[model samples]
Target: MTLKFGDPDLEGLKFLQDDPLVITPIIGNCHVMRVLVDNGAFVDILFHNTFIRMGYNDSQLTPSDAPIYGFNHMECKVKGAIQLAIIIGEEPREATQMLNFQVVKAASTYNAIIGRTGIHTFKVVPSTYHMVLKFPTRNSVGEARGDHKMAHSFYVITLRPDRTGGQPAEDLVPIPFDPLDPEKVTYIGASLDKPLKDRIKTFLQENNDAFTWTVAKMPGIDPNLITHRLKVDPTRKAVKKKKRTYAPDRLEAIKKEVEKLLEARFIEEVQFPEWLANPVMVKKANGKWMMCIDFTDLNDACTKNCYPYQGLIP
Candidate 1:
């Protein structure tokens, strides 16, 4: 008989209440990590960054045409998919099967998310009140317990907005100064007209928390909400070039800038990262050097977004 949510096996769970269902499951035979068992989601998502951390390569992804949407109904970019063997229960009760997951460039508190499709695949019934997932393997019922405290923590983490080091380096264009509040400023391409500038300045000053002037001002987005992940092609062999040396002055400036970003929690150190890319130093017109990652090789592997450009025609 197929397992059902209200099965008598779950009756003992009525005593518990008020917690989201969360559990840690092993993936690719790696250490067990937390995954939010969300029956509401139609698709299972394995974050690109988390996939890399779990020792998976980008080439493993099988291109998926179906796009996934977030709670806000915005279309999320799907990099690809990979099939992995998933095990739910322990010992004789264990049920293992190959599962396909669509990889995305999202960051979340959970390493992986198992959605309704995954739940159905395991033929399991999940209960938030019981904090457990129940399924029948053979004639016996198998149970996977949920981590209540962890699930609640992840719930709080996903609500935050996405943020990065003072905006992306590509958007480092000239900003307009606030006339009324001399200390304030607006991002690139602001209206040059004095009246409009003043109005923008006043509005910004009124909503100061919305504007971040320096690294100290940035309240980064929750990693779970949105995260930047480079989809490096794993099929391509890894490349590591010798570190390029820079002039003393330029090196000093890079060090200082890196320190500021680190202090602001915009970037964290990672060990033995895969998909190496060289940093290119560009000489700005102001004689200062700007650092940018040379992702030419990385870009070659990604699916391009072809938004047609209409030149100067109204």
Candidate 2:
């Protein structure tokens, strides 16, 4: 389909063509905001701050020795790399793709950068002048509009020398509970005094049970105390999605994970279910395959909770 930006695309955008096209796209399970669409970049990038905030551990990153240079031709340290599912545009017209992103330690106003690689992968036609992106879908062209105001705000932040470092307000340093197994560790405020840090580390080690190191260590909540039920509409017809095939290696990983869950009594086999969904394999930063269920049909049939709890109650 022919994709073109018109006057409607420039409705809310200012006449300033200098503003970068920044869009918010669903990356993995998070709706990552302030993602710069830099066509000049050679690869997609995920900033370290955003990666940590997304609940990922540094150990999850796949090792990469290769380095990448910035626009200024200066070499930037590569933290590692990760693959995540990215959805651009809204449903019915949206396109989904698993993209490899280089995670960088450098701080930036933006959480991620979708570069030329992503643009080509999505077959997107981007118009920086209109601050919009269009890509071909199954039926028609899908559109992802950029936030001009947010882009300008970030631009201003970049100009500020005090804020441009992109460093977090508070830095965290990792402290391993078991020196033998460095993988089992936790983070503490880097600014803390040496004595305070030692005390905190000791406290954590003493109460190590509080930290779940593996799935086997997880003591699941009792259903008697609290249980969740899907408010599925009865009128909605059940959907049985077709089974999806996976690579042999991914299939093996899925099998192993499923077995582990089954052994832990976390999941049980159900025969001849009315509504069925296929499992999706998402590659983790650690080069592991994570199985996820496609619950779109099930979610569509469920009613939204308008009065969700706002905060904790005594």
What are the clash counts of all predictions, listed in order?
3, 0
Question: Candidate 1 — which residues are off by over 4 angstroms?
Answer: 2-17, 155-166, 169-182, 188-314
Candidate 2 residue lDDT tens string, 226-285? 997888989889999888888899889889999989877888899889999988887765
Q: Please, what are the lDDT tens digits per residue for candidate 1 over residues 85-200?
A: 88887878878878888889865666778988898898878877667888878748888878755654453344332333124424333344456666665563343566776666
In terms of TM-score, how similar is model 1 to the real structure? 0.53
Score candidate 2 by TM-score against the native.
Answer: 0.51
- Candidate 1 residue-wise lDDT at 234: 66
Off by over 4 Å in 2: 163-314
